[model samples]
Target chain A: GAGVSQTPSNKVTEKGKYVELRCDPISGHTALYWYRQSLGQGPEFLIYFQGTGAADDSGLPNDRFFAVRPEGSVSTLKIQRTERGDSAVYLCASSASGTGGMSGGYTFGSGTRLTVV
Target chain B: DQQVKQNSPSLSVQEGRISILNCDYTNSMFDYFLWYKKYPAEGPTFLISISSIKDKNEDGRFTVFLNKSAKHLSLHIVPSQPGDSAVYFCAASALRGGSNYKLTFGKGTLLTVNP
Candidate 1:
């Protein structure tokens, strides 16, 4: 792909339902990251993957949120028993390398706006 | 605790004027800083970045100034245009696992360039 891609630009789900968001990063990008942005707030880190393995998951809000990058090229974010507070724009970014100095920083997707009512 | 802070929630500037957005960080270990601009229905795009080693970095009409002593960084847009109106976010990063990848972002400052 020419750039990072995220599916389901907008999602409206019932509270307590399960939802999944997918991200497809740029070709050959070795580093993938997930972020969540609430109203009036900047994007907050959720998780980062160096390759197929998650290098950092400290930013995940709680056990209800989980992400996996099985092949290192594509990733999925899974939410269980979603709450109304879970509504937000989920962003995905990818870099050629894990270092910003080398990859010139991340290229982000348009993001998936999740709404739980 | 907020590691990065953008005190101003909004800024208004006239076209052809200069627009300055400020940001402050509490983390002293942050060695890299970046600025991103986002429009409605779109994701943030990298605007400019400055390494701690350098006090300033510029690209086109965008210039970023960093004050390591104060843990502050600012983005300046010269001859501001209506198209430049967007939300600007400041991000900082420190080396982790031999890489500077994780970014801490500020709440963001909305810049309105009135034509």
Candidate 2:
């Protein structure tokens, strides 16, 4: 893919329901990341993946918020027992290398607007 | 406590003029800084970045200035265009355990470039 792609641009789920947001990173990007943004706030780090392994999961709010990059190319963010406060945009980004921070910036997907009603 | 802060909620500038957005951080470990622009219903796009080693970096109409002493950074856009109107966010990262991929971001400043 020329750019990062996220599916289900918008999602409206009921409280306590489980939802999954998918992120398809640019081809060959070795690093992937997920962030969440609330109204009036910047994107908050959720998790990060270096290849097929999760290098950092410290940012995940709780066990309810989980993400996986099985093949290192595509990733999924799973939210369990969603709450009203979970309504916001979930963003996915990827970089050429795990150390892409020093080289350049990550290319981001449009994101999935998850609305928990 | 918020490590990064963008005090100004919004900024308005005329096209062809200069637009300046400011950001401040309390964390001293931040060694890399970046700026991103985002439109409604879209994800943020990388704009420019500056390393802690450099005080200033310029690319085309965009310039980033970092003041390590004050823990402050600013983005300047010259000859601003209406198309440049969008929310701008300031982000920072610190090298921890040899990997610095995690980014800490500010609240963001909405810049409206009016014609």
Candidate 3:
């Protein structure tokens, strides 16, 4: 793919329901990342993956927020028992490498807007 | 605590004039800084970046200035155009070894360039 792709561009889920957001990164991208942005705030880092392994999950808000990059090409963000406070945009980004030395910068997908009602 | 801060919520500038967006950070460990532009319903696009080793970086119409002592950075757009109107976000990364290079971002400043 020429860019990162995120599924369910918009999602409206009821409180306590589970929602899953998917991201298909660019071909051959070795690093994948997930971020969440609330209204009037910048994107907040959630998790990061290097290959099929999660190199950093320290940013995950809590146990309800989880993400996985099983095949290293596509990733999924799962929110269990979603709350109203969880309503926001979930973004996915990919970079050529996990190192900051990659000059080009990370490519981000449009993102999935989740509305927890 | 907001490690990164964009105090100004909005900025307006006339076409052909320089538009400056400001940002400040509290974390001195951050070694890389980046700027991104975003439109409604769209994801942010990378604009420019500067390494801590350098005080200034320029690319075409965009320039980023970093002041390590003050933990401040600013993005300047030369001859601002209406098309440049968008929300601009400032991000910083520590670039720690074996880390995933996570970025900390500011609240963002909305730049409105009028023609």
Best by DockQ: 2
Give the chain A TM-score for each candidate. Answer: 0.96, 0.96, 0.96
TM-score of each candidate's B chain against the true B chain: 0.96, 0.97, 0.96
Q: Report model 2's TM-score to 2 decimal places.
A: 0.97
In order, candidate lDDTs are 0.91, 0.92, 0.91
Q: TM-score of every model?
A: 0.97, 0.97, 0.97
Clashes of each: 0, 0, 0
Model 3 Cα displacement at B65 (Å)? 0.8
Poorly placed runs, candidate 2 (over 4 Å): B96-99
The runs of at least 3 residues in candidate 3 whose Cα sits more than 4 Å from the true structure, single-residue gaps closed, are A100-102, B96-100
Candidate 2 chain B has its poorest 10 consecutive residues by lDDT at B94-103
Residue-level lDDT of model 2, residues B15-101, one tens digit each, is 999999999999888899999999998899989999999999999999999999999999999989999999999998886536588
Model 1 regions lying over 4 Å from their true place = A101-103, B96-99
DockQ of each: 0.62, 0.72, 0.62
Minimum summed lDDT over a 10-residue window in model 2 chain A is located at: A97-106
Q: Which residue pairs clash within candidate 1? A: none
Q: What digit string (tens of lDDT, one per residue) describes model 1 on residues A1-114?
A: 998899999999999999999999999999999999999899999998999999989989999999999888899999999999999999999998888432267999999999
